[model samples]
Target: MQLLGPAQENLTPRGMKARGALAVMGTSVNMQIGRPRLQDLLFSERDQEQGAASIRQLLREIRIALGPHRDAVVTGPGWVGLDGQIVALDMAGRAGADGRRPEFAADLDIADPEFEDWLRDARSHYEDQADDQLAAGIADDGTPALILQAPMSGDLQAAVTAAMILQEAASRVGDVLPLHVVHGDPGIGKISLGIELGALANRSGNDIVILFAARLRSDGRLLWSRRFVLPAEDSAAHLRRVAGGVTVAILHGVEALREVVTDPRLRRMPLQDVFSYSAVRLRRADEQLAQIDPNGDRAVILALRSYIRHTMLLERLAKNPQEEEEMASDMAARARELSPGNPTALGVNAMVAAWKGQSETAFDMARHAIAIDDENPIARLAYSSALTGMGHHREAEAEASAAHMSALSELGPAAWVLRRAIAATRIGDLRSAERYFATTHGYAPENRPALRFLSAIRYELGDEQGAQAALQKLKKLEPDFTLELMASDAYPVDSLRRAGLLKITRSGLI
Candidate 1:
C-alpha cells in the first residue's frame, strides 16, 4: 500500500532508512489491535479501569523482541507503535528483577490480580536490563533512551512542518501553558510529529507542557489536545534559560485550523498572509525568487515561505480586495499573464529543507511566511520549529507557545507541552516530567509519547518498578506491536546526544 512515486518499487525515500539501536515506547500497550480491540480500548473506558489480559500480552511481546537488542541507535516513526515494543521488552527485562522480590508490590494495577502475575516477571526483566548497562534506562554507558514516538500520518503533517502556526502559538507561551492541542484527521501522524518536535525543543533547554485534543467520545470530533507552560524569564538560570518548550508550530488542513483554533475572542493569526488577496501579489513577486538550482535548499525555502503566507492572506481576505492586503486584482492581472505561485506546493519545499536540518534556511523561509501574515499559526509554528532547529530554542519555544494559546487549537497546546517537557528532562527534572505527563494524559489517555516519556522519567528517577508497570499497561492498549518496527528510522531521532547536554562514556555498543 505505498504511493505511486519515483517509478521504482524497491526505491525508498532517501531519508527513510534504519540504523543504530532505537527504542520506541507506546501509550497503553493494549492487546488485540485494529478493529475489535479498538472498540474495547476506545469505547470501554469503564471496563479498562479494571484492566485486561490483552494488554499484558502486548507488553510481553515487545520485551521478548527488544530484550535481545541490548544497545544500539533504534529509530522509528511514531511512539504508539514503538511503546508497544518497549512494554514488551520491559516486561521481559523486569521479570528477572521481581523474581527475587516476591513481596514488593508495584504502584500500578492496584486492583488487578492478572497484572500482579505479569508484574513479577516484568520487574525482574527491567532490573536485569538496568544492571546490564545496555539499556536506555541505564546510565549513558551506550544504553539508548526509551524513545516513545507520537502518532504520524498524512492528515497531521501540517502540525509537523507548518511555519506560521509555530510562531503565532509560541508568542503566547508562558511558564505554565496548560494545554497544547493538534486537531485533524486520524492516521496523519500529527500527534506524533507535534510531540517529537516538542521533545527536540526540550532537549535544547526549555520547559514545556502537552495535552492532546483527541477525544474518546467521537471519531469526527477534535482528535488531539495538549497543555504545557515554559518557565518564566528568571528561572534561576541553570543556563540562562531563553525559550519556551516549543519554538514553532506546523499544521495542515486550513479548514481544520479554523475548527481547532477555538477561541473567537483571541486572534488566530497565521505566520503569513497566505490566504489574503494581497498575499497573492506578494506571492507573484516571490515567484521571481524561485531558484533554478538545487545547490542548496534555501532558495526553495524562501520561495515556499512567500507562497504559504500569500495564500493564507488571500484566504483571510476572500470577501473584498481593498479591505485586505489589496494585492488581489493587481496581482491577479499579472498572474493572469505569468501565473501565480503555488503556495501549498512551495510550502512543501520549506519542509524538505527543515527535514534536511538546514534550520537557518528553514527559519528564513518560515519567517517569510510569518511576514506575509503575522497571525498565521502555521507560519508561526514553522518559523519557531525552524528557529529551535537552528539552536534558538528559547525564541522558538516562545513563538510556539503563543500560537497555541491564541489559536486555541490542540496542536498549539501539544507543541507547548512537548517543548517544556523536553527541557525538563534534559535538565534531569524527572518529577516535573511526571507532572507534565499527568496533564497530557488527562487530555489524551492513549497518547503514546506522553506514556513513553513518563517511562523515561521513571527510569531516570530509579523507579525501575514503576517503569516496568507503565510498559505493561501500554501493552494492553495496542496488541499488534513490535520493538523493531517502533525503533526504525521512520521517526525523527537526533543521533548522538548534543555535546553539552550529556556527558558520555562510550560503552561496548553504540
Candidate 2:
C-alpha cells in the first residue's frame, strides 16, 4: 500500500512487480485471493505456466522486502494470502502526518491492461474512503472561497489587472453562481486558480505575453489549464477577450468542484454512482439524495434527480412511462424554481419536456438555456434532442455538432454523438449515421442504444458479420433483446424501418 517514498527509485522491475502483487493481495477481502485471480491481475498476458512462475518469483521478491517478516506470506495449492497475525495493512499510514492523501501505489506501473484497470478502481476506492474520513473535519463556511494566486513571473501590474478582469467576468456569467474569488494561498478543501505570464518577442521586436492559467483541486490534482498569447501593447482589449475565454473554462472547473464541496454525501460516492444508467444504481443514488435534501432546496440535487428519471425513461427501466415522466417533470420544475437562471437546470428541464412530448415547452426552455450561455454543452444537447423529436433533422444535426465541440466530459460526447447519429439516420444519410454511431460506441461501449443502432445500420450496409457481432453484444447486455423487439414500438421503430432491418427480419432474410 505504501509503495511511494524516497526509496522508490531504488526498486527494480521485479521489486515493482512484487509491490503490485502485494497491492492486489492487500486490497482483497481478508488479504486472501485465489491463485488464478492473482495470476490474471499481475501476468494476464502470460500463459498458465509462465503466469504461475511469475507469481512464484513475485512472492520471493515480496519476502525479501518483508525482511524478518518473510513468513507473513502464506501460499496454498490454489490460493495466496497474507497472514493476518503477522501482517497488518495500515492504509491510513500511507497519508502524510498532515493528513494529505497521496495516490495509492503511485510508483507501481504495471504494463498490463487488467492490472491498470484494477489499479484505477483501487485508487478511486481509497479516495472515497479518505473523503468519508475527512468530510466531518471540513469547516462550515458561509461561502466556499476559490483562491487566485498571482503569477510566479511577469508584469506584476498587468497580472493584477488580468485577475480582476477574470473575476468580474466570472461574476457576470451566472446570476446565482457560488464561487467567491480570494487572493491568497490555497487553504484545505479549497480550489486554487493560478496564472503565469511569459514574454515572447518577435523578430521585429514586437513583444507578446503568453498567459498560462491552471486550476488545481484541494489535493493539488489539476482540474483544467489553458494558454493564451496576447499582444503586450494596449493589453486592455486583449486582456478582456482573454478573460472572457478563461472565465468560461473556470466555470467548467467550478461546476465539477461545486458538487463535492456542497454535498457531503456526493463526496463519498464515486462519479459512476451518480451518472450510471443502471436502474438499481440510479435508484440507490435517488434514495441517498432524497435523504440529504428532502425538501429539494438544492437545485443541483433536484437536477440530478430529474436526470436520473429521464435516463430511466430513455432506458425503459420503468414499466410506467406516464408515472416516470410525471416524476421527471416534478423534479425539473423544482430545480428551475430553485435556480431560475441556471443553465443546467433549464437544460435538464428541456430534456424532460422533450421526452414528455411537449415540443413548445422543450424548445422554449432549451433556447432560454442557450441564450444564457451559448457554449453550454448540456443546453446544446437539449436543443438537439428537442429538434430531433420535432422532426427537424438538419437543425438537430447542427446543434448536435456544436454540443460535441463544446463538450468537456466523456459522457457529453457520447450523448451528443448519439443525437447526431439519429438526426443523420432521419435524413437518410446512412453512411454518416454509421460513422457517428461507431464514434459514440467508442466513447461509451456499454451504451445499449448505440449498439442497437450500429447493428441495424451495419445490416443495412450489407455488413452481415459486423451486424451480427453488434447484435451479439447487445444480447449480452440485454438478454431479452431480439429482432422482434427491434421491430416493436418499444425501440426506435422508424429508424429500424428506414434501415430495412424490420422488413428483412420479418421476411426471414436476416
Writing each residue's lDDT as its tens digit, candidate 1 over 297-361 gives 33223333434433333233223433322332233223223322322222333444565566677
lDDT of model 2, residue 434: 88
Overall local distance difference test of candidate 1: 0.35
Every candidate's lDDT: 0.35, 0.65
At residue 507, candidate 2 shows an lDDT of 28
Candidate 2 TM-score, C-alpha based:
0.57
- Clash number for each model: 180, 0
Model 1 misplacement above 4 A: 1-352, 410-412, 423-434, 473-491, 495-510
lDDT of 2 by residue, 229-258 (tens): 665565565665665566566654554654
Model 1 clash tally, residue pairs: 180
In candidate 1, where is summed lDDT lowest over 10 consecutive residues? 15-24
Cα deviation of 478, candidate 2, in Å: 1.9
What C-alpha lDDT, on a 0 to 100 scale, does residue 8 get in candidate 2? 23
